[model samples]
Target: MITKVTHGWRPGGLVAYLMGPGTVEEHVRPRVIASWDGLDEGWQPDTGPGGALDFQLGRLIGALQVPATRAGLPVSGQAPPGRGYVWHCSARLSATDRTLSDEEWAGVARRLLDGAGIATTEDLGGPRWIAVRHADDHIHVAAVLVREDTGRRFWPHHDYRGLRCTARELESELGLTPTALADRTAARRPQRAELELAARQGVEPARTELARVVREAAVAATDPGGFVDLLRGRGYLVELRRLPSGDPIGYKIARRATTPIWFGGGKLAPDLSMPKLITRWGQRGDATERLDAGVLAETRQTLERAERILRGARQGIAAENPDGIAHAVGDVVAALGARYGGALGEAASCYDGAARAPYEPVPDVGSVGSELRTLAGYLLRPRRRHRDDLDALSTVALLVALAALVQQIAQWRAEQGKRHQATAARDAQRLIRCTAEERRPRRGPPRPRYAREVAVDHSRRENAVAAIT
Candidate 1:
């Protein structure tokens, strides 16, 4: 079975919508958490002997509405059959050993459901919590993120890497198998390279590294185009500009490349200043003149420092203090007089090594973003798979490979047919040439045709005559 999980900010503002919608009107009393234990049959009083049918229907609808309740941020409101928000999200269990019976599978799911329910009360950070079984194939758990102290909805302004980490840890505690976790990890997109680079550097780089790299390169570049092209070749995007009014007016120069090269999710500070390049090339002053004196010196220092820190990170210098590397990045950016973009948290989140960096203009060969992201996400939600989990993942891999093989064979056959036709045409041409050079058929000396070519022609003639007769 496939296992996957997806999470993000609750769209459309949770609290307002769920609390506002009158669907759960009868049960929307302002209690912290109202129980449906006795109220199930009451909600839809119809012909039922023991209320079993009513209870089951209520449970399904209530489970579905947990997310809605969670979205609105009012846990006090009732999460009746069809009005709860699905907050924490769902997770699937992968099998490895011999397949268990339907009853055994249900037992595993019940335990997961129990774990999720217990986790909801015990680990009360995210919103509403739920665990659902898809027959015996999988389990889906959804939990809300809310303030435990005040019961107010908590909206995360940025992407929370910590949430993913929490998910991984919970999965592991729930006894998910490694192979199953691996499969789940593979499904998520890889983290950004810049973050990986930062983690490697011992700490994440400050937000300004992207600009500094471009500024320094632009300053020293005799040909800005050539320099930008070089950076692009290295997977960087460079932006050129000009100053319309400053002392450097009419000056053409290379400014900073795009900030947050990858994962430009947040905003930038308005006051931060950057060098401007003239729109019209060869406007007035020398391109070098457009480069600010202080900027050039500072850019050089920043670039050198960035290089040193990058080297240190790669060498695992600050493994003990992840924050150290992050701080250093912040310092480097400040020293270069660069502003942090709106994506600082996202950028910082990327430090987890699971986020995909924005597409680099230049790609670093041999990089593994997906693998690292999987690891990073795994760090968040670890699952300790049982033996059966491992077997299941292997089975899945085999199935995938089998599917790919079928496709490969089809392609190979098409290519082989083309090759066979080409060989036939070549043999026909050679035979024609041999016939053209022939003096007489009876008692004649053989011409010096290549031995292999002669054999191929003879084979073709024999096959042709056989087919005709």
Candidate 2:
């Protein structure tokens, strides 16, 4: 199931829409399924012809707005844009899911409102709200934020997140099609304006083009200067937003065009942001460092170190970070992509979300993280190695270890409620595992996400561990 949240100040407008013909004539038998006042209280009024408003509709709208009205909130006229008295959420079942009965839909609505704290079992007069069913597979939940008993305005804390959790639980309990959790790890989608402009100009959207270039730059460069140089080398325009102290605070990239509209790093992906990306390049050094027989040993050691750090973090409380390994892990994966340039490259791209946590900046790059970054730097150079230098067996061991770390990353992300990120991590890990699976040896069996790692011969792993659980 999927849910979307929206808000407004006018209860009349929302109620009228819910009870009337939908935007696409999709509404079928529009009527109330549930309300803050029980059905016996007549919140659902008779609809006029074609589900249009009538005198009784006024009563229903009045009932919803009473608390706000009593609390001296203006219900009509140009009172102000953000009164936000109206809270609306639309919950829709997947097309393939079983259709829910009206009573079951009511229960779902009640559970969501209770879980979201919009209206709770203990707060009988918390807020006046209703669930309206106009279609078999969905319902619209509308609530006025003003509490009936106290006439005081109520705002559900973190209700958007709350709705997501509740919706997941409801999907499980009601046998609805499961949806991905609302982990903010996904890249920022291009807005309607950007899409429209792109369509008008007959070019790829600026956000899409910029994200591709920025991600490429992020993976290839070892320093801020190199990152900038790589973008410029790619023939894109790069502009740094800096502080008065001559330090770069942020950056924007754009395609070279008559009007080069720019996009910030954050607009590309959370981890792609300058502050976070810079932290991953700790003490920038040569990306073209030679790859030799010892390079295999170094890579294995780096991955093992990261695996151990994550294992410790998992054991620690939720408050502890996995020591910002995400930034460096992205580097490691991207380096593999740069070197291998096939499925590995696609894996690196998919792992982008797994390497980022929502809203959190990458903290200090620890010793292990630094090692991973340096290893990545060495791998980024294309002319660095021969088959004999990093043989198949040793390469398998490194891939296995990297897979284990990504699996642990997936688990950590899942624990942090970042399911989207976890999914991405798993996809990337799958691609990597698939690439190495047939030839992967069976000594040190790959541990599952969040499992205790057993020191074993890296060659002895099974289907490799997944990234971001």
Q: Highest lDDT, which number?
A: 2
C-alpha lDDT of all candidate models, in order: 0.33, 0.78
> What is the Cα-based TM-score of model 1?
0.28
Work out how many backbone clashes candidate 1 has: 72
lDDT of 1 by residue, 38-92 (tens): 1321333232365322222343345434544644534443434543333433344
Consecutive 10-residue window with the lowest summed lDDT within model 2? 459-468
Tens-digit per-residue lDDT, 1-469, candidate 2: 7888887888988888888777987777787889886672256786556435332588888888888889988777774866477889999998899989888999999999987889986777789888998888889999999887788987889887888889999999988888877756678878889999989989878886677667767766766788998899879999888899989889988888888888889888777788877766654444544545566667887788778778778888432347367657887887887677778878887897777666566655566676777777666555445654446787778888888889888887777667788888899989888777755556787667544444353424542543323
lDDT, model 2: 0.78
Model 2 ranges off by over 4 Å: 9-13, 20-25, 50-85, 93-100, 121-127, 146-155, 168-183, 192-205, 232-237, 254-262, 283-288, 293-327, 336-345, 357-368, 378-421, 433-469
Local error of candidate 1 at residue 269 (angstroms): 23
Best candidate, TM-score: 2
Error of 1 at 132 (Å): 0.6
lDDT of 1 at 296: 26
Which stretches of model 1 miss by more than 4 angstroms?
A: 1-88, 93-126, 147-149, 155-469
